[model samples]
Target: MTDAPTLHFGVFEVAAPQVGGTFSWAHPRSRSADFLDPQHWIHIARVLEDSGFDFLFFAGGYGYPLVDGDLPEIAATKGINFSAIDPDYLIPVLAQHTDTLGFVVTLSTGLEHPAQLARRLASLDHLTSGRVGWNIVTGASQNAVADVFGQDAIVPHDTRYAMAAEYVELAARLWEHGWDDDARVVDRESGVYARRDGVRPVVFEGEHYRSRGYFGAPPSPQRTPVLFQAGTSPAGRAFAARNSECVFVQATTPARTAAAVADIRALAAERGRDPRGMKLMAGLTVFVGETEEEARRYEAEFDAMQTDEIVASLYAGNTGIDLLALDPDKTLHQVLGQGSVGEMGTSNIDRFLGENAPTVREILDQLKGRGTRGFRLVGDGTQVADGIERLAAETDLDGFLIEPVFEPADLEDFGRLVMPILRERGRLREGAPGNTLRARLTEQPGNDRLGDAHPVLAAD
Candidate 1:
């Protein structure tokens, strides 16, 4: 009989509070003051490393929180803060504090030039010694486009994906072919530097972006950063299959997760790549305690603090559907079927509408107390472990991106309690002192770079 697949774990977080209604400085454990503190991030890095996590994934957007074309509700309710201080700044600091922990930082294709992004990521890979991953996102919020990118409106959904395809393609050329492995030569006797022939200009002109100069940075340990994508639409999945080594999906049930995983793997296979090489991680949030009742009590406390306005604001920000404009009594299927919902185009809400058909009230209730709509696991250590194992088995998921309800404390609880159970069950990684993010996640040493089948390599 085959052994159970070795499970990888990562933390899904932003620099700020991930959940809505919990951003207040009034919270006794609030770390809002330390949003810019290097030491605070250091502490988090150490904690994650100690827990044997594979990576700390940071998700960020470019603008402030918005609701119904304005930020009034988000400002008043203090619902989800989208203004996470740049992860690019935070990763270098955290990399200095920890040895094995991997950092995945989000960057939007619509907001930055591909060549510039390639330079930044290449520099970071060297700084982190091959422990960095890039979470690639096509822009989401119109506010981000207007406020940050200085655009009049957000790009169309399908058009954004097309631009991202070209963006990544150009970036990949820079990363993969700009500099040869033997380019850097430090020869004192000859007084020579890098071999001139080993470096070449990457010239490309696409509909959305173009690059026509030699990439400035030399190759780092991993060469190109491990590519990560989170969209689940058909175009999104195709992009992930072509470029991503890791992919994230949000599904409310094991069956949905399984289907999504299968679809992604099939896409990878169609692209002439190894499906198993693409690590598919489902987003999950867990609340753990010494006892089952204690866990429920903690969840109850969180649920009690949730407000309807906060819920509506959060939903609006996510789906781009103005929940306040819709009747609470109307079911999601009814509203969506009636063509009343606007075209914001987020995969999470799309999946929800397609799969669950929950009412507006039910959707609000689901969002109450929860930061994300991913699967929720709440119980003692054994119960949580069982839930994880069952979910993995049923869904064929490679791992989970654990979303913390409360910073550090929730993670601490999982590390102290749930990790041991997972370890004993052979569902967790044995702590390794020095491992690249790619190595740790793929569980294969010396596999530090993208596989030959990766589209980036085809440019050669």
Candidate 2:
């Protein structure tokens, strides 16, 4: 029999009081209220590093849904994905507190100029000793963030992705070829700091963006941060095949997840790239306990935190579809038939439109449980491990991006209970001694760089 694949583990979080529909910030067991506290983050970093997690994936959202310039009342009042302090600032701070755990921060292509973004990430790469990854998003909340950026209308979805292609190209060139490895030579005898002749400015003049300058920072442990992308659309899958080292999938079922993995790998193979090189990480939330009955009780308590109003508001904020405004008795099919969802709807909406059409009431119930986020497990250590092991065996998933329902506590429970079982089964590897995030994830001991087949290496 073939040996089971070792799974990589990461925590999905945001620099906010609550993540998604998890309105458990006010719950007695939650530390989400301490979001603004430096110690809170410091505590999280230490726990994760000590728990043997691979990285902390910060899913950043710049703004809430604004319909006709009016913010949803419940979004603010209930604290649903509201007040997301910049993760870029938080990542560096957490980097200071921990050593091995990697960080993957979301940065949108529509948000800033490539030079500024590139320089920031390169600096982070150095500061973290190369334990950094970039989760590239192409303005999923365009209309919501448009007013904040002083734009009148949402940019077309494909247009944003197209612009992102150029944006990443410029950023990659700056990281890869902006300066020679020996460009920064500090020679006291010759009174020379850097060899001017050795440094060359990487010039990129694309239709969407143009950059012609030396990279602000030198090559860090990983010249380019490990690229991660989460999109399952035709364009997104293609983009991931071409650029991402790890692809994040939130499919609702094992079969769907397996198909997505096959599709992307096949796309990569067609492009003359190694199909097995890219890793597929699924989003999963686990309510783990020592006993099956105890786990269900915890899941129930966590579910009690979400209210109907908060559910409607959070869903509206994410997909621009107001569940309350629409007739609760109406099926999702009826809702979709009324108009084109266009860019407003996400893959979550697509999942609901699958095999069976669910009513608005049914959908709201799922949202209340944070169903749209990803696959969920509610069981004891043995049962949860069984689910995880079976899913990995069936879907060929390399890992899971664990979403925490309660701040630190949920993750703490997972680390204490489920992880040990996983390790014993040989489903999780012991902590690797690799210094860089790329090296750790890829299991290469010393090399902290992207493979030659990566598109960034070919960027001009």
**Best TM-score among the predictions, by candidate number:** 2
TM-score of each: 0.93, 0.94
lDDT of 2 by residue, 152-204 (tens): 77776677778888888888888888777788888999999888887898888
lDDT of 2: 0.81
lDDT of 1 by residue, 132-246 (tens): 9999998655553566656766666678888988888888889888988898897899987899999999899899898788998989888778899988877788888888999
Clashes of each: 0, 0
State the displacement of the C-alpha of residue 408, model 1, in Å, after optimal TM-score superposition: 0.9
Give the Å error, residue 368, model 1. 1.8
Tell me the spans in candidate 1 whose CA falls farther than 4 Å from its real position. Answer: 19-33, 76-79, 332-343, 354-356, 431-433
Tell me how candidate 1 scores on lDDT. 0.77
- Residue 341 error for model 2, in Å? 3.1
The TM-score between candidate 1 and the true structure equals 0.93
